[model samples]
Target chain A: MVHVGANPGRSGHRLSAQAARIVFDTRQGLAELFGVSDSRQIVFTSNATAGLNIALHGMLGPRDHVVTTSMEHNSVMRPLRHLARERGVRITVVAADREGRVDPAAIREALEPKTRLVAINHGSNVVGCIQPIAQIKEAIGKVPLLVDAAQTAGSYPISIERDGIDLLAFSGHKSLLGPAGTGGLYVRPELDLPPLVRGGTGSRSESDQQPDFRPDKYESGTLNTCGIAGLGAGVRFILERGVETIHNHEMNLLDVFLERLRRIEGVVLYGPSSTEARLPTVSLNVEGKSPSQVGGLLDKRHDIMVRVGLHCAPDAHRTIGTFPDGTVRFSAGALNTTDEMEQAVAAVDEIARS
Target chain B: MSSGKHVVLAFDSIHDVIKAEKIIVRHGIWCDLIPTPRELSSDCGMSIECRTDDLPDLESLRENGALEWRDIHRPE
Candidate 1:
């Protein structure tokens, strides 16, 4: 495909009219994907981190208290920590099980009357363990729920309204297959969030004051129009492929990889042993081998791309007993193939033997 | 595809197409946006096509800062 701008905001005169239509249709498609109403509830951001910041800053104040889990990416954890340290907002981090899963009952026990928000990651980026968000939401009662869906948005089915999620943050690049610098937050229409950024949205040009709306309220300055434009294309691609098929393919690959990893004598896997309860992302360390060493061998020797280190989630690493040194991460996508997984398994087996 | 008429629109940027789409849809018009057809000029790679009768809606779109308007079937 030619590299066309997916950006509806900056297509200018050539596509001045149609660009807007594309974005509208794209939002409708996304709303259907998430089983939500009114595309207006979705606000575009530069990335998932930006969406998290918007949700965190918009919903909570100095006197509020927040509840989160240890398996969060820095996008969620760092902002909450900052809020606690600087603004005097109170936060409680519920610990996760060794498999990196947060028990919903633990979260319920951590809640207080002053709790304003409950933030949780839908899936652990390090171990790929999926959280029990529905149960957590049930336990939260009236408190608002924010789900960090960076690793699970397109890879799995997420229904914001049906699941009782007040806010959701996702990245376009990871599984949505769009360019970087594109992501969004889905805020339920009822919650009134403060504007995170203030400037031109081209909608309220007549007034000096910024428009108090879902997207325009948060979206300030010129948007990453080109990135979002590509995101439209990426979203269309995923919709056409069907989310269920994609999930099945990923789980099948994970199944094969996990079975092979288990057969290897010295390899130690993290997270749930079964593919049924986790994403396709697998983290593991071979006996007598550092994660970086195995990662380098996989890349230099086998020409395979994998992520190593804390995966920007130190708490998740700590929860799974892989902290400090981290572990090799293999995140499968819709485009990943079974043969590739076999090759990856073979490479790991050889490395473990060495 | 012949049952429905298609109109090709060119945009200088992606933002314009996105904005224009929202305006037209609110008026109950349906349109499809695709990578700018290759037979058309290659300046940009996205276009919109919808029923030809929606031309008046096009004027409203232009009033809202939409700049380019072209009939896809116009003879080259």
Candidate 2:
């Protein structure tokens, strides 16, 4: 707010200095969280969707073959579909199992000789199953791997070096505890992912050409400096708390919720039964009640909050046989406690019975 | 304009010039971005101005591909 209320913009030391600090702190913080070697590789975007768009538009083009999955959100699916319609690019979608798990080997078989990129979600926002990128990377060979970490970023310990993730798009609002409209991607220094939008970057005021740099090349126009300030603080908070500890807290809550939830009569759960292979996000449907009804009852009567409906991954619902109706999403976050989990279980059990 | 023999590096684009400013400033070098003198060229872009003694350092920057310059101009 200090940055915004103070009238920050180009041609001033206050704004310029704040920009520099935002660059330093946010980069350093995200780099530390993701285990990136250099902070320069991080480029802020409006959201993970925008970052994914930049990656897709910048890397793939006509005649290039891309491999993705049926479990992708519209963010990835819509862009690829647009490219398919307009650019004549070829896309092969690897199908996930009934459990919403993609066989790592099947992904390799789907890889064509001309496959330019393999874009996958680190974890499904709808089904809540974590994709095994480490295993999938071993099969991907030299193809670039783009992991959408919107669901896993601040909640999971993801190492680009260890996981062999080539490009990672993350949302600051989700797990990083940052403001909305604040997110970014970490591009490998050797790789050049071109800019999706081009204009003045405040640096290259002379020529109309975009600057050919890591960040400025991709990040053109005036940035969300205030949101970036909040994002920087958010990342710092994650670092102080330690990602593993946060993950443990969320996982423990999941353990209790799952143990009680599976025993409830008429309660049907989707995705992995155990939380070990996914985020703390769980999806389920009660016996007789619709997703909306359950969600309404939870919110109105129990004062519980959750994301419901297709969760923006329709294909994922189809994979798990929940299309059209969707499921109630009980996602545990950084601040959610075990007490809340018990209450959530009891409420769901009550709703299932009533 | 200023009565001194200064080193002004001409760049192809504004992005290069801004990057040059950031790189130069980070290395403890004091430089100012100013409009190209009207007598110098018709490009109508900005240049990074420094002391004539900074030539070796500037040349080194150019050698390493960090800075790209179209030409070096010394106002008479």
True contacts kept of each: 0.19, 0.02
Q: What does the lDDT come to for candidate 1?
A: 0.80
TM-scores of all predicted structures: 0.82, 0.84
DockQ of candidate 1 (2 decimals): 0.11
Q: Write model 2 residue lDDT over A87-168, tens digit each, in one string.
A: 8889999999887888889989999888889999889998678899999999988899999999999998899977888999
Estimate, for each residue in A128-224, the C-alpha lDDT of model 1 and write its tens digit: 9999888899988889999999999889988888889999999989998989888999998889888778876654344688766555667667667
Collision pairs in model 2: A204-B14, A204-B15
> Where's the lowest-lDDT run of ten residues in candidate 1 chain A?
A1-10
TM-score of 1: 0.82
Residue-level lDDT of model 1, residues B1-76, one tens digit each, is: 2344556665433444565555667668887666565455522345666676776677666777643443353212
